[model samples]
Target: MGRAPSDSAGGDRLRFLRSFLASPRKVGAVLPTSRRTVDNTLDLAPLEEARWVVELGAGTGVYTRGILERVGSDARVVAFEVDAQLSSILASQLRDPRLSVVSDSAVNVARHLDGAAVDVIVSAVPFTSLPVPERKQILRAARDALGREGIMLVLQYSPLIERELRQTFTYVRRRLSPLNVPPAFLFACQGDPRSPAGER
Candidate 1:
């Protein structure tokens, strides 16, 4: 049998569940991404050489830890979690100098980056669940914020947005993770994306 959940982890799980209950559409998942999900999604990025990393919908900082482990101490990580309560928990839990937990929408990523050279973008945000406009905005922001060699890693339960990704990104590759709770599709996109007008 597995050990019982620790007090802190149990509390965190409760909070996560509460957030999902409060906003099912926004929260997207009842549980955070599993370790395998995080690893499979981030493997496509060159974390070792990455100087700056950005995370979208960093619900509970699962992928944040993975990025930190792979990168050097000098690297910077900026994570965006729209839910204030979840962001608070993430800030308190991950007290690393290299990490910044921002309580804002993923679309505001560029402003938070403030002209930094971003090397990798890992997104746990449920794009398919979001409003179409919001999804487009976040995708555009990711494309604009990336450095010349930057790569955006998107984890989704479905491949429904592959068309959108292909239009916004110059190249897109996907892989599936059957081990995850709901399973997942990991998209690795690189190069400067075309404008929305060009998408048509």
Candidate 2:
């Protein structure tokens, strides 16, 4: 028989804790993201109409499951999880054909896109913990991978990413989810200034 919901949740939390303990900087959080934060993040994303969505740092598939619920049947979600064990767990647990789990870094997101236009990119990455160069590289890659009208939603524990985000995109908006553990700042960014459409 399948595990009870409570048991599943407990397992998820344990997995998250182990992953975080293994690589605090990469995993970012000791617990799974709160439902409120997930709702807030998805509310800002244009997922219903999105053909392709990318999730960065998809720990325990919290945001990934939420994205699947909102996106249409034809929509595809590419989830990047740096933790190998967590990635494997995510792939096995969420057996949806539309979801692709990438056991890799977000910096290589574009390579896996196959030239399809991405409508939304949801990032739960711990940018504050990464090296400056790596952070910038990942941001730049995400910017280039998106379509002209694509939007990138980022969830962070602090506003430190605002400056880097503004440097990459012409538009940036921030919101706060106070109920999340340690709370979180959500950023919606578009209009990559380096892109030709952004220049127009």
Task: Say which candidate scores most in lDDT.
Answer: 2
Candidate 2 wrong stretches, greater than 4 Å? 1-7, 196-200
Residue-wise lDDT of candidate 2 within 1-200, one digit each (tens)? 12112217888999899888988887777888897999998899778899999999998888988888888888889999888899998888888878899999999998898998789999999999888888999999998888888999999999998998999998999999999998999999998786666741
The alpha-carbon RMSD values of the candidates against the true structure, listed in the order shown, are 4.6, 3.1
lDDT value for candidate 1? 0.85
- Lowest lDDT sum, 10 consecutive residues, model 2, at 1-10
Deviation of model 1 at 123, angstroms: 0.2
lDDT of all predictions: 0.85, 0.88
Q: Residue 69 CA error for candidate 1 (Å)?
A: 1.0
Off by over 4 Å in 1: 1-8, 195-200
Clashing pairs in 2: none
Model 1: how far residue 77 lies from native, Å = 0.3
